[model samples]
Structure formats: C-alpha cells, structure tokens
Target: MSNWVEGQVKEIKWWTDSLFSLILNADVEPFTAGQFTKLALQVDDKRIARAYSYVNAPSDPNLEFYLINVAEGLLSPQLAKLKAGDTLMIERHATGFFTVDELPASEQLLLLSTGTAIGPYLSMLVQGDVWQKYQHVHLVHGVRCNADLSYQDKIKQLQAVYPQLIYTPVVSRESANLGLNGRVTEVIKNNRLFDLMPHCVTPSNTQFMICGNPQMVKDTTALLLDRGFTRHRRREPGNITVEQYW
Candidate 1:
C-alpha cells in the first residue's frame, strides 16, 4: 500500500441521518469500475483509515464514496462531518477485482447488494462495458427501510434509459410502496426477484455479482451454489463473483 495522498472534498450528499455520499478531487492511477480505495482522516491525533468502494465510474474525474455513519465507528463519524474544501487522505492506488469483467460471458447479469454495498454496483452500472456485454442487467438493492434506499432515483433513471435494465429495491423492515417488502434473500428464494427480470436468472444463463452484509452474502452464495452456480476464481471462472461487505 502507498502512503496516503491528500484530496480536497468537493461535495457531500447526505441521503439520511446516517447515510451519505462523499465526492473528492484526487489524482490517482486508473482503476476498474468495482475497485475500492482507502480513505483516511486525522481523528484524536491519529490517522484513521478505512477501505471504501468507489461510487463513481473509473472515467469520472471526481472520486465518490458511499458511507454509513456508525454511531460508534471511529472513522465514519469523522468522515460524515466533512464538508467541501476539507482535506481527506486517500490511497494512491485503487484495489480489488470485484468487477463484471472477471466473470465469463453470460446472457444476463445480476447485481445483488445491501445498504452502502450498492456503491460499487452503481459505478459498474455507469460504465458501458456491463451493458455492452450482457443482454439484460438486474440490480437489486435491499435495505431495512425505504429511507435507506439511497440513489433510488438515479437507478430508476438508468432503468428508464435502458430497456434491458431492471432495478428492484427491497425493504425488510417497514412496508414500502416504493419497493418489494421482504428480505432480499427471501425475495430471491421465493422467485419474486426473477419475476422482475426480463430473462430467467439461471446459473447457466446469468452471472451473479453479490456484495453487502456478510451473513446475507453467505446465505445467498450457499443458495446459489445449491442451485448450481459456481464461484469465480483465477483457475476456474464461474457464474458468480462476490464481495462481502464487512
């Protein structure tokens, strides 16, 4: 890892009391759509840093990060307090291979995520490569409440522009007219998710990209494996690519 590079905060978009997106102007090496970078800030005289996935596409001039303010977290609380013109530290290199190009060619692409894990998928969606390769794309975002479903309008706008794109939001806690009311795993388990896709989300025809809560990732991965999907690896490229949000 490289020493931290300083970047100036360009903007901050707070979607809820605890969730927000940060935009920074930084110069760094190019990275793939789903790659992540380290962010740091001085707190209590200590340089606190954490890895965050990029929300902006690789082509974007500004770097964007979707973050959650954990009441007890050391870094997030400080990150949430940042304003435009504030200095933020970032790694010189972007890292991770959680991208669509890692998977084999498929007819359909499914992006499953929860909470801020939707960040990386949003980066991938804005890139032309994903749409160019797959005939259909499905993005499912799951949150505890409808209010936590950030970037909903942006996703819907993408859906409106792309006939092959399907955007489904799932709320697990409260009844939401904006989205399906259920856990994401339950929605997938009951075939409610597939109903929204233009093509059947099958192991043979679709490639799965899952990111978010570790437990949800574990359960969903197990479910997919049981139904015949294979996990991607260097030696054997498969139907599913996963990134667990810790």
Candidate 2:
C-alpha cells in the first residue's frame, strides 16, 4: 500500500506575491486541528516533499494549506507554479502535537504565530473547540508587513461568532491601523501587547502555544520562561507549548 495519495489542485489563492493558499481535493485520513501533513512532487525521478500545516478544519471537504514562496526553495517555488487540475502527492496521514487537546486546562489560551505559521491557529479557531475549552482565546499574528497579514475576513468572521476570541495583529515593518505596531516579542516585552488584551497573562491563568519561524519561537519561549513559565511536557505538564515552523 502506498503512503502517498494523489491530490488534485482545486484553487490557488494569492494573498501576496510570495504568499498563497493551495486548496486541493484528496481522500486523506481524518486529521486533528493544528496538525500537519506532507505534500510531495516528483522532480527528475526524485521526490521532494515538505510539511505544511492544514489551514482548514477536519470537517471541511477540501484540504487547504497556506504557504510562502521561498525564493530559492526546492519545492515551494514549484508549488507556487501549480495551477488548477494539477496533481501532487499528499501524505495519507497527518501528524503533530500542536492540537489544543494536548494542552492542560487553563483559563486563557494564547496562540502566537508568525507569517504562514498562522495557518494552524486558523484551523484550531475555525474548528470551534478552542472557544469551548478556554475562557479567553488570544490569537496574535506577527508579520513583517501589513500585506503579509492574510485571512482578515475569516478572522473577522470568527471574532463575530465568538466574542471570547480576541485577535491581535502585530506588524513589524510598518504601521497598521488594525492592531499593535511592533514585533510580537517587543510588544510583549514592553507590556504593550498585554495592554491590548482584556485579561491578565499570568502563568496560572494562561497557557501559551507559540508557533512560527525558529527565531520567533525561541525568543517568545525565552520571554515566557523569563516570566516563570516552563515548557509543557506530558509528564511535567508546564505552561508553554511550541511548534517551530521551518
């Protein structure tokens, strides 16, 4: 039996020159929200594959993945060139421990992501379990520029339906009217990030899920550690849970 199954591209949504969402139709096994699966393409008889977090909820009929075209990337540049009806190989099963189910009980859930790393949080948010599980949900997306912030409409819709969901968009490069204007770590360090939120962010009341570029994840986790938060583990059960989006 083959582990890879064929997936037909249904649509390509370009949010910016470098960022896009690839929507496909494939018969993949049920995946939990916030998990990721691999997508592959055959190049010169050698298969190249990369892992992408699912942007769509498990109930959604189609599979959606948000990605940025790395200028010199082996697979992403080719992925960006794909058009409707093109076929690619998708891993039959998804895997990751980023799901909300893995977190311990807490009053607040802080989901922090940078760039396309926001995809998994979008999945968890749309799936509707986060709202019921946490009293307050803070979704912070940090992007280099205003244009990098995608899915505003979807985030707004989710906010409308779930008042408990609070979104904060941090733009590091330029000014943005929507949310705070600084890097996520900088804002948090200066207490500006906490000022925007309605609830307090103590380790006892909040559980942090940090995902994004390796640097952002490392810095954020370090800051949280400085504030007395510890890395979450199955046996130890601490405060911070992280997934590095390479």
Best model number under lDDT? 2
lDDT of 1 by residue, 1-246 (tens): 556788999999999999999999987788999999899998879899999999988999899999999999989998988899999899989989898778788899999999999999999988768987799988889999888989977787788778788888899999976768898889888988888887666777989999999999999999889889899897997887999776
- Model 2 TM: 0.98
lDDT of each: 0.89, 0.93
Per-prediction count of colliding residue pairs?
Answer: 0, 0
Candidate 1, overall lDDT?
0.89
What residue runs in model 1 are displaced by over 4 Å at the alpha carbon? none
RMSD of each: 1.4, 0.8
The candidate maximizing TM-score is 2
Error of 1 at 199 (Å): 2.4
